[model samples]
Target: MHEQDFEVDYLIMGAGACGMAFADSLVTNSKSTLAIVDRQHRPGGHWNSAYPFVRLHQPSAFYGVNSRALGSTLATRQG
Candidate 1:
């Protein structure tokens, strides 16, 4: 089989953040068909195995995609 064999608007290689976001945008803006495939069992890419110290280095509000807000919240230090 070749590229022409399968019919799809977008062939997403990985179901990572970028791929997922692209698919989401396509779904909301156009009627394109997407084929998302990932080596991992689920999405989130490296995040699935990210280091324990890895997190929103800044704030949650600035960590999410533009399409969806992370829900801005007032950060409070816990003793």
Candidate 2:
């Protein structure tokens, strides 16, 4: 494997739901170099494979990283 220079404050290997979640939170909280990589061509991980209108079993608020809030609008609307 090619060893790429990864001298960032944060380097996320997967741009999946968890990867993006952490990166987003890190960017929002502090000034850090963030990199996200995924074998897939998009974010949201496997959810993208699922049908539309199919929501996560767990609330988005609980899924994403702590610093940033995902689906805040959805949560507010649901409440």
Candidate 3:
């Protein structure tokens, strides 16, 4: 696709956690617009395609957008 088709102050290539985190920081720090595109059908890169039986080895609180925690709390384990 042409660059003009999708114009933004920044063009983030991936929509993974890192990419989203960076975008969030940029958005929070400035007014610049951004566009993120990923090959996957949805966001959350690896997490999205992970096996259904698999769970995050680390707590979800540390694995999402910087502005918000993913799960209730890392210290707490729920069945």
Candidate with the greatest TM-score versus the true structure: 3
Encode model 3's per-residue lDDT on 3-54: one tens digit a residue: 5565699999888878899999888888899999999887777876775467
Name the 10 consecutive residues with the lowest summed lDDT in model 2.
70-79
RMSD of every prediction = 6.8, 5.6, 5.0
Query: How close is every model to the real structure, measured as TM-score?
Result: 0.63, 0.57, 0.66
Query: What's the lDDT of the predicted structure labeled candidate 2?
Result: 0.72
The TM-score measured for candidate 1 stands at: 0.63
Off by over 4 Å in 2: 1-7, 50-79
Model 2 CA lDDT for position 10: 70
lDDT of 1 by residue, 7-73 (tens): 7988999987788888888887888998999998987777777843564466666645645656456
lDDT of each: 0.73, 0.72, 0.77
Candidate 1 regions with alpha-carbon error over 4 angstroms: 1-6, 52-58, 73-79
Descending-lDDT candidate ranking: 3, 1, 2
> Global CA lDDT of candidate 1, please?
0.73
Error of 1 at 61 (Å): 2.4
Error of 2 at 40 (Å): 0.4
